[model samples]
Target: MDKPDLTRITTLLLDADGTLFPSEEPAFGASAAVTQAFADRFGLTGDFSAEHLRRTTTGKNFRTTAQDLLSRRGISVDSAELEMWVAREKEEVTSHLGEVLLPHPGVLAALRTLNRRYRLAVVSSSALTRLAACFTASGLDHLLPPADRFSAEDSLPVPTSKPDPAIYQSALARLGIEPQQAVALEDSATGVESAVSAGITTVGMVQFVPPGERGDRTAQLEQAGAVWVTESWDRLARDLADSTVVVRT
Candidate 1:
């Protein structure tokens, strides 16, 4: 992979779910709960595992992911019903917020260090409420406050989710930076696609990916256009510091 031209990146846009907040367990659990609820409601007999949830729903918006889940069970529903199911899933996930969400190791420190030199923002497919829950849980709420946060909820009347570039474009417009002047950190192929499509140099984060699947995951992110793939925030922090030196000289 080519070295990223970090010198031009004055702002950083981060993906929350797998990148900043690593508590994917609860997210998966919530999806499972909602899927099961639908299954029970429809009298379907198959089970949904966390792995299945992670694989299918990780980078998608709630509506899209939920629709995918329902489709897997040979069921189909209209927008209103899908929205209702999504609401239930959000409620179920919110109830277990504390147990399912936490910051990744070294992430807080990296954020603190990076915040000193670059503007930081969160761009997520997650709803604003759930994003707030994770940010509050991880104590990242203060660092990337509301003004600097953009969620699916903010992507109104446009392409409303990741892999669409609308959210990233909105964030860039708000931050007053060009896409070439920013770097995006993301953990899923879906997010990588979104960032890359938005014209930002993107780094694929793999710290939260299971050890056995990381290699394949790395390949996936690369295929989706991540310029770099890393498993350690500490290492990324150091690289950023080094990049600053290059920028100065």
Candidate 2:
């Protein structure tokens, strides 16, 4: 997990929900509807916005965010809640999830280009099933080829999820890679923290911009140790490509 490790980084760890697609809006509109249903089912009041879930979790990891969010609201839920919500609401909002979070343009090209040189892996803290559906729906799953996509369910009895570094570590281990030989792309504070802590190079993709100046996220992400931050998928590809060059040099 040192500088030399980065030079040989041939693994690319990716966050699915927010990073592969976009944030600020639901990947599947149904998620929002289902989320509201949960809020209502729990008798919780107010609109809970995790618009920047991806960008924020990039530092901490997704598990920490989910548990912390629940603890904050006194809501005793687990990662399973997300899966349940998706199963129940997906049918209703299938169009939204399928439509709203369209793949970032040129991302497939980036994936394809990098795939030739890097062993790409999807390391999400979300449920694997749900992510697989979204990826399939968006055609990203097809574009992803045979790369390994890791979620909370596959590793640990649920280590509180992301921002914990557990998923990243699991993905790397599963791929027989070392931390220093991997670079993770995250879109959330939680994710950033997790990857950095794991000693992997972390790049923050600011996929979600707070509504109407409600927050300053980029600065916080940078402070959280995000080595790179940008909105363009192309820039992200180029920045990461440079890492490969670093390795070869």
Candidate 3:
């Protein structure tokens, strides 16, 4: 992959979960319960481990992940039932947001350094409410702020989830910036695809990836067209500061 043209970039679009904030512990537990509920409802049999469910659903929006999970087990449910399941999962997860969600190590310092030199915005596949909750809990909301945050829920008339460029495109349009003027930091394959497809310079963040899985995760991000990958936000912050020398004319 080519080096990101940070010299020309004036804005940073960041992913929320797994990028800035660690995955919520409650959400992980809730997802396991929801997955088991589906298995019981469908009378399917297998080892439904939390890690297994997480791997299956990571990087996907709630409804999409639910559908995929059911489809993988050859279990079909009506739209209302699917909605009910998703709502249950969200309720359980969000209820414990305060106790479970926290910012990743060095993410706040990195954001502070980046915010000094470039316009910062959060572009997340999560719903706006969920994104707000996490940011508020982690105090990242003060830096990114509500006005600069974009979410899958913001894509209206037609829903555009990650792996689609619509959310990133909408963010750029709203921020009044060109794709070339922005750099995106993402942790998941879906998030990388969204930013790369939107014509932004994309960096894959692997700090949150489990130690054993970093190699595969890094390869996945590279395959998704990330221009660069790093496991250290502190290093990335310095690199960005060093590379962003060209002023926007």
Local accuracy by lDDT, each model: 0.79, 0.62, 0.78
Which is the better candidate, 1 or 3, if ranked by lDDT?
1
Stretches of candidate 3 exceeding 4 Å from the true structure: 24-26, 43-47, 71-76, 103-105, 246-249
Off by over 4 Å in 2: 1-5, 49-70, 73-95, 99-104, 153-155, 207-215, 243-249
TM-score for candidate 2, please give it: 0.74
- Residue 225 of model 2 has an lDDT of 78
Which stretches in model 1 have alpha-carbon errors above 4 Å? 39-47, 69-76, 103-105, 245-249
RMSD of 2: 4.7
Candidate 2 per-residue lDDT, tens place, 125-184, comes to 655555666677656776564357877644566545666777777777778878877878
Q: What would you estimate as the lDDT of candidate 1?
A: 0.79
Error of 2 at 162 (Å): 1.6
List TM-score per model, in order. Answer: 0.89, 0.74, 0.88
Candidate number of the best lDDT: 1
Between candidates 2 and 3, the lDDT winner: 3
